[model samples]
Target: MAQHETSGFRSFIFSRSGMVLLGFLAVAGYFLWEEHAAHILGYLPLLLILGLCVGMHFFMHGSHGGDHGSHRDEPREDDR
Candidate 1:
């Protein structure tokens, strides 16, 4: 007969103590979010604007081919 082996972390999480710890973390996170809800909502607009600016800065740049000088050296369709 062969015995199966489990990792220490995996075994602990499947045990009772890990379940209690996970429950405690869930309750704590719920209360923390409840208490700070107003503060987080107050910054929502600013966060959205900042995210838009950063997204546009990164995404819009890709519209142009990255080669700045090489295009000038390539023959134009008119030349062909």
Candidate 2:
């Protein structure tokens, strides 16, 4: 278990996305340390709006039209 955990950690540290995230956090930490909270806060709404728009775009079209049930809504001719 420890070995697996260590390997996963190593891979995350070496991965491009993970490295970018680490860099982002480091920069954010520096800004926060410099008391640039207001500057960062100014972009909060933009980020939130962008994130929600992206989430809605992906999820809104991801459905496969499966809401219709297996059985037909209309009665069969034999039922007449």
Candidate 3:
């Protein structure tokens, strides 16, 4: 019997449309959390936003610059 082909996480992460949609959702979530839930978070929106930005930055850009920290070393704009 032939094995079924499955992309699993790769399909979701590598899709251009998925990335664009995820980016939009991230921005929208940030705004909603900042404007609506800041008081609930003790007004730590700046910290949250900074942390999120840093995390995404590290995920998308860090490994591309010869950094051995990332698990998935996908190609970046510089390599194109």
The sequence of per-residue lDDT tens digits that candidate 1 reaches over residues 31-65 is 99999999999999999999999999889988686
Per-residue lDDT tens digits of candidate 3, residues 20-71?
Answer: 9899999999998888884777758778999999999989886567646564
**Candidate 2: where is the Cα deviation over 4 Å?**
1-31, 64-80
Kindly indicate the candidate among 2 and 3 with the higher TM-score.
2
For each of the candidates, the C-alpha root-mean-square deviation to the true structure, in angstroms, is 5.6, 10.1, 20.4
Each prediction's TM-score versus the true structure: 0.70, 0.38, 0.37
Stretch of 10 with least lDDT, candidate 3: 63-72
- Candidate 1 lDDT score relative to the true structure: 0.93
Residues 1-80 of candidate 2 have per-residue lDDT tens digits of: 35435587788988998999999999999878679778778989999999999999889978757765655887889999
- Quick one: best TM-score, which candidate? 1
Model 1 segments more than 4 A misplaced = 63-67, 70-80
> Which 10 consecutive positions of candidate 2 have the poorest summed lDDT?
1-10
Most lDDT-accurate candidate: 1
